[model samples]
Target: MVEIKDFKASDCNALWNINRNAFRKSLKKESYEEFKNITENSIGKVIFLENEIIGAIFLKSQSEVGTFKVEKFFICPKYQNRGLGYFILTHLPEEDTSIKKIELDIDESSLKAKKFCEKMKKEI
Candidate 1:
């Protein structure tokens, strides 16, 4: 089963490793710094399958009520294509009923991620 939990200090290293391995090209020094900044500054959460850490998400509340901006989100490369991402996207409302909208920013070049988000939107 997949689980979502509050981010703990102890999760730092595992989350770093997961992000590093998941988006090898994107986790360069500058981007890693950005990741650290976001994780430290935002509301962070960790995603797990069984007891293993598999992903992380960082979000910040937007100005609008019940709106949140996704700063970063990633599932470990090894854990992709297992319906976990879809589940997380769809089920977050169950975890926080106050969430009226979830917003994400994706680079134009990241076609795969855009597609995934689109699919999730359709499902929703």
Candidate 2:
């Protein structure tokens, strides 16, 4: 089963490793530092499959009320190509009914993410 939890200080390394692996192809060495800085300010949630951490998501409140912008979101490379992403995206609203909308900016280099987002749009 998949579970979601609030990010804790101890989960930093685990979450960083997941994000790093997921974007290894698109991010340069220096970009990781930027990621750390950005995540520090955003509200984060960790994704867990059973007892293991599989992914994380960071969000920032948008100017529009009840809207949140995704700052960083990634599932570990080992867990990709499963239905987990769709499951999490679809169920996120259930975790917080106050969230009226979720928005994100995908990296142009990651066509897989783009396609996934498109699929999500069609499904929703």
Candidate 3:
């Protein structure tokens, strides 16, 4: 079963590995490091499957805009295309009462992500 939980500092290495493998061609070690550092101190969620870390997402408060920004979302390569991304997005509002609008910046090159978001909108 897949489980979502608060990000933990101890998850650094495993999370990095997931990030690294997920975006091999575009992987940025420094960015992942920064993400790990920030997530360790910030409020975010991590997805685990059978005790193995598989995905990570970070949220930032954008109360000024009345939205919750999805700062980061990454899933390991092996776990992609399994509807987990949609699951995370669908449950974001339940995780926080203050979150009304869910916002994210998707790379223009990532057609799959754009399509996933479109699908999520329909699902919600």
Candidate 4:
């Protein structure tokens, strides 16, 4: 079963591993620092199955009107296509009552991301 929980400091290595495997581009040597930067600016979480982290996400509040933007979101490539992404999007709002709106952006070149967002739009 997929589950979401607070991300822990110990999960950094696992998060990096999953990130490296899930993407085609090789991350820079400073990727760890970049990860720290992103997570530090947002609320972070781990998506786990049993005890292993299979994915992760982060959010940053966008405005005073209760708008929240999805700052970072990823699912281990091996765990993709299993409906977990959509599940995360639809359920995020229920976790925080102050979140009256949610937003995300995808690179136009990434068909996968575009499709995912389109699917999320339909699902939510």
Candidate 5:
């Protein structure tokens, strides 16, 4: 099962490690800075599978209404095919009934991520 909880500063390095493996050499130094910025925010959460941190998401409210924007969301490469990404995508709405809309930016260069986004649209 996957669980969501507050992301603590202590988890930054661990998150970096996961990011490293997921993106490999494609990751830049700015990604770490961005992670720090997001982790310090009141929003965002760490995803855990059986007590192991496998992913994290950064969220920001788009309005006073029920819209939310997912600034960053990812699952560790090692944990990807186990359906954890799908779980997170589904769990977001299940956890928040007030969220009438959700949005996220996906890199068009990544066919895999684009496909995942398409799949999420179908499921949602």
Candidate 6:
């Protein structure tokens, strides 16, 4: 069973591990560090299964863009393809009532991610 909840400061280590394992070569340590820092003040969610973190997504308010930017979204390889991505994306609005739209930049190599967004009615 997977549970989605607000990220806690104590979960930094687990979040780091999830991010590292999920985007190994495509991302660097600095990216994770930046994520940690941003999550300190931004809105985000963490995915957990029996107390172990399996994925996470961060959203930052971008007034200039007129939407919430999905700063990061990652799922451990073992937890992929289970509809968790869709679940997480759909639940973002529940966190912040002020956010009207969610925007993200998916890597061209991440076809699955692009498809997921498209399925959710989000365009590139």
**lDDT string, candidate 3, 1-124, tens digits:** 8788888778877887887776665524447658666676556888988988898987887757547677667899888999889888877678656667777765444566667666666765
Ranking by TM-score: 2, 1, 4, 5, 3, 6
TM-score of 5: 0.81
lDDT tens readout by residue for model 1, 7-123: 887898889889877666542343656768788898887998899999988879999998888777889998888888888877776877777778866534356677776776566
Which tens-of-lDDT digit does each residue in 1-124 have in candidate 5?
7888777888889988886676664424446777677767636778998999998877788866877777667789878877887777677767766666677666454567677777776775
Candidate 3 vs. true structure, TM-score:
0.78
RMSD, model 3, all Cα superposed?
A: 2.8
Task: Write candidate 2's Cα lDDT for 10-124 as tens digits.
Answer: 8887778788789778744435568777678887878999979999888798899978887777999989999888887777778767667788665566788888877776754
Global lDDT of model 3:
0.75
Estimate candidate 1's alpha-carbon lDDT, on a 0 to 1 scale. 0.78
The window of 10 residues in a row where model 4 has the poorest summed lDDT is: 21-30
Backbone collision tally, model 6: 0
lDDT of each: 0.78, 0.80, 0.75, 0.75, 0.74, 0.74
- What is the Cα-based lDDT of residue 85 in candidate 6? 83
Stretches of model 2 off by over 4 angstroms after superposition: 27-32
